[model samples]
Target: MAQSEHLTIPVGTVGSVDSVGAVDSVAARMRALDAALPARDGVAVFNRVYLAVTEEVGRRLDAGGFADPCAAAALDVRFAERYLAAVAAAAGEGRPPACWRPLFQLRRHPGIRPLQFALAGINAHIGHDLALAVVDTCRTLGCPPAELEDEFDRVGDLLVSLEERIREELMPGPDVLQIADPLTHLLGSWSLERARDATWTAARALWALRSCDDVAEEFTDRLDAAVGFAGRMLLIPLPD
Candidate 1:
């Protein structure tokens, strides 16, 4: 029952594209990511989960799911641009935002579980990038965060739904998740629901600080550092 305009390829399949900057370029980015990163790589694990979410959103958009498809697309593209920017920076100058430094640094460390990589990336993206992306979307669409509330909520809901799947798909297995395992303790400490709520609050706060350039920059910096700290903790190397 998919719409006629929807892409025929399954979600998470990367394909050739000119660039990752366009709203239609998510699948392309995903495709590049899949081709570039090894299957067991930490970043790839998160990228696959993220790619699925992005493709699903695209399908919903094609089906006219959002009240404002334009707003939804803007939000989606801006959000993705932040993540891609981090990747590019990490690959080149080795200076991504504080929130993203951990994942990039530990991406290939065998000691870090796939679940940890996935959640740490989620923390960086949601805790830091999401607020900025909201502002970016608002600026691009020439509106305020209040105007994009519905789109924001819808996208957040999608993320929330995927969080469960990520855990289930990446989990080390029931025997490995015993209470004695540090992974269990690590997994229990972070909650996507809490992170989503915090991001919404931060977005609203940033929107309010739009006129105060210095204060807003400082606020953003602190948020980045704090999220990065959490990511560092999440990426703690566990024993094999």
Candidate 2:
């Protein structure tokens, strides 16, 4: 995708706010992006999926689902900012993280299925961004990863459920999807449950290495590149 193709959304608009207001702002920004992108655009597909998740997270916050509402809100907003920043970067000369590059680059490829685009985006966000978001949340909230464990798990559980729905709604049906299908193999190689577990570990590791700036930066860079590689694999175009 060209730089001009990525319509700029002012990422800073979703600034720090109280618990309820923070989530509301994130949902609002996502909804705005949903309205701006082409319906069939790959990024739009993922944006719609994320917006649904964000709205659901907001609903849960309203219903008092999280044990630590404030921590939850902080984590949620920080998590969302990483994605919004990537979008903003793609819109300008700034480069998005390696983890997010594939989706931005392949957003308009016709041969890639919507499922592929969705999972690729999920892979990058969950596999790389979520871990850093956890660290970011910890710093902002002045707590350890363990303190934020409940919120992380709750948000992750929501994502896992959403992944199921995405597959159900987007995957080729049994009659059409054959044993030899490349999509099956591609999708099978990645698992959200595993990614979530790994992200938790990475978050903890990042927290531990925080004092070692150089080491932490190297680790983060490696994580970004690895997730980007996985995203590229997930986005491999298959026969329609």
Best by the lDDT measure: 2
Q: Write the per-residue lDDT of candidate 1 for residues 131-231, one digit (tens) a residue.
A: 99899878766798999999988999999999988888888888767879999889999998899889989999999999999999999999999999999
Predicted structure 1, TM vs. truth: 0.89
Candidate 1 residues lying further than 4 Å off, grouped into runs, are 1-21
TM-score of each: 0.89, 0.95
TM for candidate 2 is 0.95
Candidate 2, superposed: residue stretches over 4 Å from native: 1-6, 13-17
**Residues 151-205, model 2: lDDT tens digits:** 9999999999999999999999999998899998888899999999999999999
Give candidates' CA RMSD values in order.
Answer: 7.6, 1.7
Q: Kindly give the stretch of ten consecutive residues in candidate 2 with the minimal lDDT sum.
A: 10-19
lDDT of each: 0.81, 0.89
